[model samples]
Target: MSTANRDLALKKIELVPGKRVRQKSKLLQYIWFNRYLYLMLAPAVIYYLIFHYAPMYGAVVAFKDFSITKGILGSDWAGFKHFEYLFSQDKFWQVIQNTIIISVYRLIFGFPAPIIVALLLNEVRARLFKRTVQTVIYLPHFISWVILGGILINLLSTDNGVINNIIKAFGGTPIGFMSDETYFRGTLVFSMIWKEFGWNTIIYMAALAGIPPQLYEAAVIDGASRWQRLLHVTIPLIRSTIILILILRLGGIMEAGFEQIFVLYHPGVYSVADIIDTYVYRIGLTEGRFSIAAAVGLFKSAINFALLVLANRLARLMGEQGVY
Candidate 1:
């Protein structure tokens, strides 16, 4: 609203009685006007409160020598003991290194994959072919990682796997993509890209759809080529979305697909593929070290939160609307 008009409205509201009381009435009326919208939002708000925020109370388990029989609040306080031991472990540092390296590999190779695919799909004039391709690629996103992991094991198995069979047919050596430490991380990255990149492409495609046709029309009139139009127009319009998704991704740098890794990793590939989440699962859940597990989970949350805030701050400094 214009400053003058807003001041005029406030003056009219103030003339009714106590200025603050009238202002409060206006705010209540605004809420009343949008009551149905708020009603629609209630379930989502309640979900987060119950499933996300309420469980935060259990984070104290990280600081306590927690016993399941004793419960969270009844446990003896261990102060920083859990965190101290977590930091002291050389294995913990190796896990951290693996996590960062895997996350970086995803960021470098997997991040731009969707953008490239979305751009290519956007340029395709054959709608039938495009739809077929989209459906084929997006199918994996709906399937559970367990199923995909099994399929990948069979497809890439060193002992007469389909891929190895093809290699042998072509007079090439059978390489262990999943079992060999040299190829394990790269295989993880490739499969990750193949599995989820299409889902991300949907986001980019949505953003591309929102671009005003008039902008493209203007570029065409100005004798711009398709590449020029994309560079000067399409990318600039979707810049905020790219920035927002990137910031959210940075926030989850500690996560390296726990489900996928858990299903696919074995002792042979653990050195390269084991991430922080898997380590926590081994010590915290399977080994029943509740306090240490809670501590590691809390540490991961703290790092993610800090990265989110930092990424948002940097995005705002760079004049982009980051995910707030």
Candidate 2:
């Protein structure tokens, strides 16, 4: 086309509506045209609506004197009585401290473990050996915490257990790992790493697979050693994936593995092992403090939401993609 004709065509395009408005109109048209496709999505939509969103109405009970006889709507308003009760209890602060400490320990030790494993696996040349290692490591993740808890109890037993037997062989006293408060938190952290590190590596391995081979080849040609290539080329490529996963981990700081703690913990280690979810279970179901438990749960959800938003904002500020 001639230059004048091209200029005229550009002018005509410029006279059209803004891109955002046009995009929305096109999306509506496409959705209407392929309404059957959306019909296929109805089951998932309905599932979330029914199971996830519909129950949110019960959250109002957190601010009420919730009674089995009185429905949520019919319950008398108690303002923040439950919340005030929760904040005043010393046990509540202890549970909060335990939760934060355990989460921080997991973030420190558990987070980098999978990344290290994935990097080492990437270096392995023997496919059979690599697959065998991966299979063995991943097996623990599929085992339920209830079963694993029993296994741990047996293994860490002070009498006639494998670890205690070894300790006796070395002339050291048998340690009550599960029962003693001193060792209980360490046991929790180690158990978590053993159970979930392999499963977590799957994500890092996938990210590693997407790193271009050309970068490694170029690094090699530039006289980079194996370690140099890994440090300079591989790490930088997966940096964004690491940052994204870290942000997600931060958002879950309030939830410190309820099932594992519940299964492994006893009255002996309650000082170190009690956390928010376990406390909620004890107060809500066992003690029948429904309103107080609901208030605590609501507080937990609010904190999680705030952390998620803060992490997303930080990611954007650091020039990475946010979850939003």
Candidate 3:
């Protein structure tokens, strides 16, 4: 309470121990031991530093009237003009709603798909079959969304498309999956799951591999069945990994597959399918509303950063290792 007492309390607090000469020497020794490996990683580190970290400097454009003629340095300061306009736009809220709906749907339906696939793969007795299935599923993840979108367009096209053909054969009405507002979101969510679920499963399978056989042995000895052992031991052990992934997902709350939306979206479904990233593209590049786009991007990034911090804090409170 008193200034002197406060000063004394501060003085009493110990500083964190720094790396001493011995520790420094040990670190150097370890580094030198794997010098070649470090050398291999150097280019990637430098690339990220130059390309990723350096570009963050250009975020200043959000506060300026960025002009090709003036350049970033000579651009006129606009203060918070873009930000104010961004909030005033009614479509901004619509884009945000679309982003949230798509992202939340993906989280609900797409997130667990890989986990289920991994579990099923783990249960398979035949290694060859499991590997084959994994390979087939993972192959889709490598295909570019541009190509996949084309395929989806043809397959879901209203006029004699594969899906429509099947629907007609079943005496059902042909639905325009891509252009229809009702089905557009569902199609996007399902297509994303189909594309990435297998690749996502790899991480969960790796985590499953680290699970000790001894736990299962103990469970079996205690008269636990396979399902019970899975429920108790396997799920519980991988719970932290799942939570960590969920927290990381929360960090990207505003990002709802830019590539997917850019490729799949059409004018008819734009109301429901247009997300923040797509809106930014149209405004910034197409409409030449550079500052407005920058403002929207900044807002998205700020919310993502805030969500990341909150999610990390929640993870820590739940006794899990957070990204921080």
Candidate 4:
């Protein structure tokens, strides 16, 4: 090469390194400026790393014939044997079906409950009355299902329960809400809605509050009625929030409330109430089938991840921004 060309090549290489160093310094400076904000986020990041992501390492047991004495790494590799065992069982299918049914019921019924409550609250003219209503509904969320379970038992028991006595007063037959198979699933769905719907409304309430007042003014000047304003102005603004929450909720479809179900359900209702989480509790902790339990837990996680991805893709296809 000519001396001029060699000199130009060296200059280009020097410029490239100088440009990269400037970019790196700018990134560090940006992070340093935002250090306090990141400091606030550190605890949450640490928590997921410690409690959620750290335990993921133990998922190796799903592929192992795990023994407490042998430990995770020392155990013999089973090579999908545990999953094959799970697939071969009829009870596995039953449990999966029960889980999907209960979750879908909640998705259909419970998902709309919060939105409806938020809308009603939005319409209320009396601040005092609306605040009281919100407090009354939100109280149940603070109480654990253990306390609520005892309360429900007294209220819904088939034999001389509070509700049953009221029914008998009206010359009606008592319903077996807790013990019978027919009513147990309904009871589960209803109780979940009653427990969670109020708490869930907080998000929708915030979404409603964020709507620009000018848009409502424009709608009113356009001669839109209150109902028309809600349909045309309110719902459209909150659609993205609804889609975001729904996508996140779909990721937990397999979790059918082990604490609630275990507290209320008995063998009579097992056909309908037995779900993946409860089954994991029974087979893993109660029965000490470590490998099988690990297999079930891992499988549940895979399904949840797939659903989250699918929901995000569908949301994007509908021309909305979804969590990626």
- Candidate 4: lDDT over CA atoms? 0.94
Q: Please, what is the TM-score per model? A: 0.92, 0.89, 0.91, 0.96
Error of 3 at 216 (Å): 1.0
- lDDT against the true structure, each candidate: 0.93, 0.93, 0.92, 0.94
Q: Taking the tens digit of each residue's C-alpha lDDT, what string does model 1 give over 1-324?
A: 999999999999878778778899999999999999999999999999999999999899999999889898789999999999989998888888999999999999999999989989988999999999999999989999899998998999989799999999999999999889999899888999999999999999999999999999999999999999989998999889899999999999999889988988899887888889999899987999988988989999999999999999999999987876
Best by TM-score: 4
Residue lDDT tens for model 3, 5-69: 98888766632234365688899999999999999999999999999899888789999999989
lDDT, candidate 4, 1-324, per-residue tens: 999999999999989989999999999999999999999999999999999999999999999999999999899999999999999999999999999999999899999999999999998989999999999999999999999999999999878689998999999999999998999999999999999999999999999999999999999999999999999999999999999999998988988888999999988889999999899889999999999999999999999999999999999999889997
**Rank list by TM-score:** 4, 1, 3, 2
Off by over 4 Å in 3: 1-27
Question: Model 2: per-residue lDDT, tens digit, 202-281?
Answer: 99999999999999889889999999988998898898999899899999999999999999999889999999999999
Model 3 lDDT-worst window of ten: 12-21
Lowest-scoring 10 consecutive residues by lDDT in candidate 2?
12-21
Please give the clash total of every predicted structure, in order: 0, 0, 0, 0
Q: Give the TM-score of candidate 1.
A: 0.92
Please give the range of 10 consecutive residues that has the lowest summed lDDT in model 4: 249-258
